[model samples]
Each structure stands twice: as C-alpha cells, then as structure tokens.
Target: MTRSARRTRRALQAAGAGAAALLALSACSSSDSDSGSTTSGSSASSSSSPKLSGDVTVFAAASLQESFTTLGKEFEKAHPGTKVTFSFGGSDSLAAGITGGAPADVFASASPKTMAIVTDKKDNATVPATFVRNQLEIATLPGNPDKVSSLKDLTRSGLKVVLCDKTVPCGAAAQKALDASKLKLTPVSYEEDVKSALNKVVLKEADAAVVYKTDVKTAGSKVEGVDFPESADAINDYPITLLKDSKNPETAKAFIALVQSAEGQKVLSEAGFLKP
Candidate 1:
C-alpha cells in the first residue's frame, strides 16, 4: 500500500477504537439505570433495618445559649440512639438559616417577629406557644459607679452607651422601652446582638446598654442590671416551633414539649425570664 493509504488506514483504526470505548461507557451507565428492577427489592430490606440514626440539629437564639445548652445536655441524656446539636445565634440569623434550607429539626426564637419569618415559610407549627418572656434593663459597671438611673442617662454627655441594631429582637425591645419612656438614646455603636451590647458595658467600653435581664444573670458579677418600669412595656415574648423538614420529628416534638412544660418555665425564670 502507498504511504498515504497506510496513514489513512491507521487513522480510521484509531477512530474506530475511540468509538468503541465511548460505546462501552454508555453501556455501563445505561445498564446501571436499567438494573433498578434488580436493586429495588434488596434496597427495601436494608432500609427497613433502622430509620432513626442521625443527628438532630436545633437552631436557637443567642440569648438561649446558656439555658438551652444546659437543657440540651439533659435532652441528650434522656434520649438514646439520638444526638442533639445546637446552633445558637441572633434570632433573625437562626430564622434565616431555617428558611434558607439549613438542616435543622427545631428552632427557638427570641421574638414572634423572627419566628413568624420561619412559620410563614415551611417551618410553621399550628400556633407556636410562648416559651419565655424577656425584658430589657440598663446594664452598667459593677455598682452605681456611673450613677445611671434611667434610659435618658444612656445619652448623657461623657457616658458612653451601646445598643443593639434595630434588626435584633433586643434592639427592638430597647426601642420600645425608650419609646415608652419617651427617651431618645444616642449610642456610640449599635451591636448585632444583645450580648454584644452588654459586653461593651461589662468591658467598660460603654457606660451602659439596654439588654435582657437573663443576659445580666448569665454575666455573673461582671455587670449590674437596674430595672426601669418601661421594661414592662417592652417584655419580649419567646416562641419555639418544630421545623417541618426535620430528620427526627419525634425528638423535635419532645424538645418543644419540654420547653413549654412547667419545668422549662421554671428554668427560664431562674435564668431571669419573666412569665408571659
């Protein structure tokens, strides 16, 4: 054969081999999909063995960290073959996570507004029962060192004040308290959460901030909380709901039940939460 003819023949041979390999790959994939009839029978046997053997994630508000963590441990001890994981953050953050496809079995928020964001979506639970009540307070350095009495004092010249942004529940409640007292406070900074606002007071970076009473109790002796009658007008209501796409629905229901039980209220009360 001529040289050109030989090269042409070799190229055709190579192309034929490549085509054969492509055909083999397609055959394998098609075979797998077509084998569902054979695999389906055995799959059910394996699936029937065990169903509840995964983690249950609970997303809660940052303010519930201390109490919820303690209670989470108790819940884990009570349930065998189940693990409870917690993600505590701002209520709005937690709600966003749940509504944004974050895998969570339960959600406990600091306010009805944040909870509504979830309930309005797929996480709604009939009508969420109120779990706890939180009120605002003027947190200052240990003792009346700043001599801060009312919300107006937060804006006094030379008295640095910190507050939460209006997005957070605590900040909204603080705004209500200020509105009730008819006082406008100029804070040095607006924190993302109540804890951050309280931390500025504890660190002495800010002379005062309006935070939840439970946060004050959680701070131990690092700060002092003074009650103002305006707190009554700003009591925040906490509501918890079980997510609809939970991996462990039973565990989620139990957790919600525990939070609404008398024992749960007592725990919240000891942590400085008021009854609604």
Candidate 2:
C-alpha cells in the first residue's frame, strides 16, 4: 500500500474509535442522569411523610370518653409503635388545661365557646373543626322510676334534679334547652361535667339529671334516657384541633384525621352522637 493511503486508513480508524468512545461516554451519562433522578424522587417521597413513631396526647370533653377511647385503641392498632393518652373532663376544664401549658397534642371540645378559650389564646396549631354534635337528654333512674317524661317534669317541687355547672358544655346546653322552653329549673346540685351529673342519677343521688344524649347512651341500663324537643334547640357542636405546643405533631395530625374519618364517625354514631 502507498504511504499516504496507509496513513489515511490509520487516521480513519482512530476517528472511528474516538466516536465509539464518545458514544459510550454519552450512554453512561444518560444512564447516570436517569438513576440520579430516580434516587432524588425516592428521597423526596420518603421525606414528605416520615414513619410515624411516638405518643399522641389528647384532651377531650367528658362526653367523648367512650367513643374516643375506642378511636384511641384503633389508632394504636393501626400504628404499631404509637400510643394515645387522653385526659377527659369538662370542655372548659380541658381548655383551661391546654391554655395553662399542659402537655397535650390535641384538644376536642364539646362546644365552640369552650374551644375558643384555647383558640383565643393561640394555643391551637390548626383551625378547630367540628367533628360531632350532642343534644341534652334527661337521665333518670333505670326504668325511669320518676316517670320523668319531659323537661317540665323535672320541675316538680319534691323531685330532686341534678344539672351540670353553667361553665361546662353539658350545663350550658341544658340551660339553653330550659330557656328555649321558657322553663326554670333549680337543680339540687350543679356538677362540673356530664359524667358527674349522670352519676347522680345512676347512683340514685338525684331523681334525674340533664346530660348529653351520648352520655345517657353510655350509661345504658344504669339510667333511662328521656328525649325532649327542647333539646333539639340546644344541640352543641363538638370541635377538635391540634395544639400549638404539640411534641408529636405528625401523630397528632393522624389522630385528628382518624376522628374526622368515616370510620370514626361510625363509631361515634353507634355511641349515639350526632354528626357535625
């Protein structure tokens, strides 16, 4: 072969080899870019919702004891490593505790007015949402021994009736119902919470007590529930929110979601609570 031709062929081979190397490099770069994007997307997905672990503390109204207990159990079962602890009492009392720097992740109140005590103090992390409602009912001794059929029946001079304190949701609702009927009631005693007032009837301490319908249902055979029309006018909306000082906000948020979920509503309904 001529020298010029040999040189031309050698240069052509060198150029071909360089092109192959460039193609190989380009392929590797493309593959690396795709792998990097996939890794980045996975990292984002995992970070957006970290695995929930830790405890959620809830302060709820007295009327929510049973239903909330059931929900707490469900939450624990759903999240293996998580737990829920509740402080149940009068709405006013719970709100006061939250505002007083009690360590709680969530707050569920029986009335908007009571919830305002926390919200007004800017103690809530989120806007309160009404999850349920309750109406007043007359709880009497089993079989309604007193035959307390209506709201007016409790006014009998000799019959002793118990009422929740006006500062509490149950008491406020009872008063509203009484006011709606243009009736006056002077209870033998005023209790701090619905459970306290209902206990009066269950223990036969009083002839009857005005409490929430849900509480009456919880009392079951312990007391008889008397439905009154005036109660409809005094239904109380139940609100729930995450606390601003929550130590486990993610878990608290999950619990709040569960409470507002369809399953949670089912449990509350079965317990005789009204939907929001």
Candidate 3:
C-alpha cells in the first residue's frame, strides 16, 4: 500500500475510536442524570411522608370521649397501619393508672391538676400542653322538669342532685362555681366521674347534675344544659401529653399533634368544648 493511503486509513481509525469514546461518555452522563433525578425524587417523598405506625393506647378523661374518639378515628385514617385504643374515665383515675404503671401511650386529662399527677412523677410523662378548656353546666332531665335554672336552684330542698366527687376535675369545678356564687350545695351522691354524675340525671336517678358543658352536649336529647354565670369562675383546662413509656413514640406524638391541630379543634368545638 502507498504510504499516504496507509496514513489516511490510520487517521480515520483513530478518529472513529475518539468518537466512540465521546459517545460512551455522553451515555454515562445521561444515565447518571436520570439516576440522580430518581434519587432526589425518592428523598423528597421520604422527607414529606411521616414515619408513623403501630398501636397506640390513650387514657383520656371522661369529657373527651366524644371528641377524642372522633379524633382517634381520624388519626387512624390519616396514618395507615396504625391502631388507636382509648380508656376514658375520670382524669384522676386515669392519672392514677398512668402513675401506677398502666401501659398507656398518651394521657389527656380534663384538668391540669390531674395531668400534674403524671407530670410530677419522674420519667412518667412528657411536658403537657393544654388542648381545650371547659366550663360547668347544669345537666337536667329532658325539658328540665325540675324547673332548675341556676346553681342555687340545685340547692332547693328535695331535689336529688348529683355531683362528681371533689377529687375529680368536674367535681372540683362544680365546687369552685358554688363557692363563687357564695351558695352552699349538698349533693345526694358524689359520683366518681362526670359521666356517672350526669348519668344520675340521665337515668332519672337524680334531679340534676353539675357537670361539664361538653358532657351535657354529648348527652344529646337525654339531658338539658343550663349555663350559669358562676361557671365563668371555674373553667377547667384540658391538657394532653405523651407518656414516657410510650411503645410507639412517633405514633403517640402524631396523635397529640392531631389533637392540637385545627381539624381537632373543629371536632372538639363541635362537641361543645371551648377553645384553649
């Protein structure tokens, strides 16, 4: 072969090899860009989605039954694979259960004092946040047959009135309202919780019940609610907290957030609980 032809062929081969290398590099760059985009999108998705799952048990005050139950359903719906179980009763009793080592993930009390029973103990509770406030109301049988209107009317002779035991929040608030009006009342029975006190009137076992406004509302047509001015002097604040021994801290925290959220406020307000 002629020297010039050989050189020309060699140069063409070299040029072809360089072009192939460029194409390989370009292909690698494009593949890297797509991989990086996929990685970035996955990261964003992971960051936005909360990691919450597992079972969560909540011990709540009797007054929270309706609202918190509604919220629990919502929380479970919002977070798939999560279960919410509740034990509703007097705040004092629930507090004792927690401080006594009950397996509760969250504690929501009708009164700050009861929440203190948990928060006061070492490693028993997290700092509590007041989620709602409630006021006293007179819950009488439908139509208020006793003609009871004011706190003093409860003092009427022969009226079988029921009040929560003084140790509980409802009872404490009732006492405060009574003291504010400078009126004395002697309830026929001091029930353990507001629900029981309200039940007394509900079952026609008593003439009336001095209970939380929310309780009357929850009772629906079963009872009539009467607001007294003295209730303004004895508002009870409801507080919620995550327990230290929470089996699912993330789920518990999410539940607390749901309770304090605007959606939670709407549910609570609908149930007659005043905003905090």
Clashes of each: 0, 0, 0
lDDT of 1: 0.84
lDDT for each residue of candidate 3 in 1-276, tens digit (9 for 90 to 100) = 999999999999999999999999999999999999999999999889576899999999998998888899999898889999999998999999888889999999999999998998954557889999999999999998889989999999999999999999999999988888889998899999999999999899998999998889889999999988989999999989999999999899999998999999999999989999
In candidate 2 the C-alpha lDDT for residue 50 amounts to: 63
Candidate 2 residue-pair clash tally: 0
Tell how far residue 35 is off in model 2, in angstroms: 11
Candidate that would win on TM-score:
3
The Cα RMSD of model 2 versus the native structure comes to: 6.1
Q: Per-residue lDDT of 1-276 in model 2, one digit per residue for the tens?
A: 999999999999999999999999999999999999999999989888667879999999999999999999999998889999999999999999889989999999999999999999999889999999988899999888778899999999899999999999899989988988889999999999999999998899899999988988898899999999999899999999999999999999999999999999999999999989
Question: For model 3, what is the error of residue 119's alpha carbon versus the real structure, in angstroms, after optimal superposition?
Answer: 0.9
Q: Each prediction's Cα lDDT score? A: 0.84, 0.94, 0.92
**Cα deviation in Å at residue 255, candidate 2?**
0.3
> What is candidate 2's local distance difference test score?
0.94
